[model samples]
Target: MRKKRALAGSGAALALGLAAGYPCLWRHACLTWGATAVEVHREMPGDALLPTAPLVTTRAVTVGAGPAEIWPWLVQMGPGRGGAYTYDWIENLMGLDMHSADRILPEFQDLGLGDTMRLGRNGPVMEVAGLDSGHALVFRSQDGAWVWSFGLYPSRHGTRLVSRNRIQPPDPSPLYRLFSLYVMEPGSLVMERRMLLGIKQRAEEPIAGR
Candidate 1:
């Protein structure tokens, strides 16, 4: 009887701990996954991609390299190119066939407006909608439901890389909106954070012979 009571008490304590921790987890997810006030108000060049998307997410990171160095990585990102620069195993599980490159490839360096970049083997296709060379690149889905943009700005340290995604789900029902807020936001945060950090690491690496 004593052992049973102790086990019950421990289980109750564990449940209480989990219940107490849930709020912190939600708060962290909201702040990290959702756009900040500045990002929400700041006008992004890629805003034209969706024009009026109700859902927007902005994530930024400072890189220790100039915009020129970062531009190459952005331009060459895709399934058949330099890869998404995120977790290859996760992306491969989703059939992206990602193989991130460690060095710049010349053939993939010549991206231009209107070119189609494959996200995964069977994932959505994104067409280049806007290009500002070393400044920004914006891509829009063929259906016009999704727009993703990458911006580079000169900073005191080196460069600030900002990634913004605008998504207008085909179904704007409350259920879909709720799903996006609760599910998509957290998932996107995980993938995007990794991609941004990956870019930062690659951009900061010293160029061979330079």
Candidate 2:
């Protein structure tokens, strides 16, 4: 029992030590998750939404459908609309008031420039900075510190959905910068990766199956 305990303790300590020293590796993997080198460096449609970006990350996924078929899912995403195609239970636990929808909602399809999207029922909101049906949708935080861009491209298999984020928080504190580097980047990886997979799953489901 003593030997086993010592081994477990050593393993945990090693993992923590690696995490502390592995911030760059972790950030790199998260920044380029599910993306090719070309895709990671690709200049997406809404890149112009923000000027002088301090940080940027790009991720992507392939869907077995056309851009048109996958567009409705993007159009209706929000806290109270069709949800973010992410972990609703986790968001709700944080009082974000989100729920994933299984089908396209017609009411939310007419999204336009400057439309507001809430992260929670009563939380931070993002504005529609850019939109092009079946092509791209971009959202910017109210403070203009963050911009999220989603783009769809024709691919050999079907379509490639790419998500890019450009961040330049205005006057960020040292603590905030450290927290973002250590916590936000990795945390976003878990949530956003699941979101991409979720959208791919939904877009690929047959209409009859759905």
Candidate 3:
């Protein structure tokens, strides 16, 4: 009886804590997960594309490998190419046929400036707006309202893989923007956090014969 009461109290406290932190969870904390102050505020490669974007998120991870080791994984990311390195089931549920590859795909490695990566089977496409071999890659939506970039910087541990996104939302109404702050912000945290972890895991794997 005493243990049950203790557990119930603990649960209630947790619930109350979450409620109190909802605002921070919505955007403040979610937007900068795994990112240092410098990374969160620094200018990324594709910032000029959406200079005045209202919603911007900057996330980073320290991969135990060099940029060249992780560059292939980024090159092969998308719905059809090497998949987004995320929750494939959740993505596929939304009609995104994502099949994450376990190895580098030679065919998809030639992603170029004019290339477009379709979001899903019939989803809107994002065009490759910038690329700098093993250092940076940026993509933008056809309407020019969203920009996504990956910047690689060498670190003492290994490498700092930073992902930044800038978006000039299609609907800028107060309510809509607030809804994004609560819903979309947390959702992005879930997916993008997993993506950074996934890339880190793959990039740190040792070669078979080496």
* Per-model TM values vs. the true structure: 0.82, 0.89, 0.87
RMSD of each: 3.9, 2.3, 3.5
Steric collisions counted per model: 0, 0, 0
Two-way lDDT contest, 1 vs 2, winner = 2
Over the stretch 1-210, how does candidate 3's per-residue lDDT look in tens digits? 999999999999998797568876545668888999999988889999988887899999999899999999999899878988889898999898898887889999989998997787776689999999989999999988889999999999999999998988788798997778767888889999989999888888853222
- Colliding pairs, model 2: none
Q: For residues 14-79, what per-residue lDDT tens digits would candidate 2 score against the true structure?
A: 988877876655678878899989998888877887857988889999999999889999989888
- Residue-level lDDT of model 1, residues 1-20, one tens digit each, is 99999999999999778656
The model with the greater TM-score, 2 or 3, is: 2
Q: What is the TM-score (0 to 1) of candidate 1?
A: 0.82
Q: At residue 142, what lDDT does model 1 achieve?
A: 89
Error of 1 at 203 (Å): 0.5
C-alpha lDDT of all candidate models, in order: 0.82, 0.87, 0.88
